[model samples]
Target: MVYKMSVYYRATMCITLMLLLLNLCEKGYGVNLRDMQVPCEEVYMVKEGETLNSISEKCGDPFIIEENPHINDPDDVFPGLIIKITPFRLYSYKF
Candidate 1:
């Protein structure tokens, strides 16, 4: 019947829209949206022979020491420590 066809068409249109959105997001938009949400921070693993300052410099966040108060001692940082930096969204990273 016409009603059944219309329902099918609507369902198909909705599915197509959802697929397009998902594809766009997966390609790039998803990360941008993810960065907006709370508790999103980069987890950096300390490498051997690397200091906090050096790591922070590599990360491009100069004031990382002040930002991460969780680090009890700057000098005490060692390999395998996961330093959590504040949420950062690069211009290129955003959609």
Candidate 2:
């Protein structure tokens, strides 16, 4: 009977320690929505009467600025174009 009681007490202590460690680790690794929340980059759809200057004002500046050599070429951007105002970074979680 004494041996059985000792074994049961040890098992109980081990289970309790395991539970405590698991709880602490979960809190350390869990991601809170507010902590990870990031603002979405604003994108503009080119309109018929929109100009680059106006778009720049509305969307701030682009991360990259490349000037097209041919302003009148077929690939030249016009009003009502979709432009990305911000770049995104990939994030990894390490626990």
Candidate 3:
């Protein structure tokens, strides 16, 4: 009778742990990229009426000029100009 009770207690603990893990997963409590500040894209093309400031805000890349040294003038960004965007989170991970 004691052995049987021990077995049942172990099974109950296992089930409780499994249910807790499932509940956490269902609640989205994990390392989700969407929940983090990730960059929208690595390479971005300048669109009409879009400035570096606007792109930085939209893409989550604050240092646009630093990433793309070719951008001589921040104000000279024109449509179709390609630029490299590295989000601060990704940049920090590299080091």
Instruction: Output the number of the lDDT-best candidate.
Output: 3
Ranking by TM-score: 3, 1, 2
Q: Write the per-residue lDDT of candidate 3 for residues 24-59, one digit (tens) a residue.
A: 766666644444565666788899999999999888
Model 1 lDDT vs. the true structure? 0.75
TM-scores, each model vs. reference: 0.45, 0.31, 0.61
Better of 2 and 3 by lDDT: 3
In candidate 3, stretches whose alpha carbon ends up further than 4 angstroms from where it belongs are 1-19, 28-39, 88-95
Which pairs of residues collide in candidate 2? 46-80, 46-81, 47-80
User: What lDDT is reached at residue 64 by model 1?
Assistant: 68
How large is the C-alpha RMSD of every model relative to the true structure? 6.4, 9.3, 7.4
lDDT of 2 by residue, 16-89 (tens): 99999778656765443334432334554667766656555555453323432223443456776566555343
Model 1 — TM-score against the truth? 0.45
Which scores greater on lDDT, model 1 or model 3?
3
lDDT of 1 by residue, 1-95 (tens): 99999999999999999999888877886465555543334777788999987876666667768877888899998888887766554443645
Error of 2 at 63 (Å): 34
Q: Which candidate leads in TM-score?
A: 3
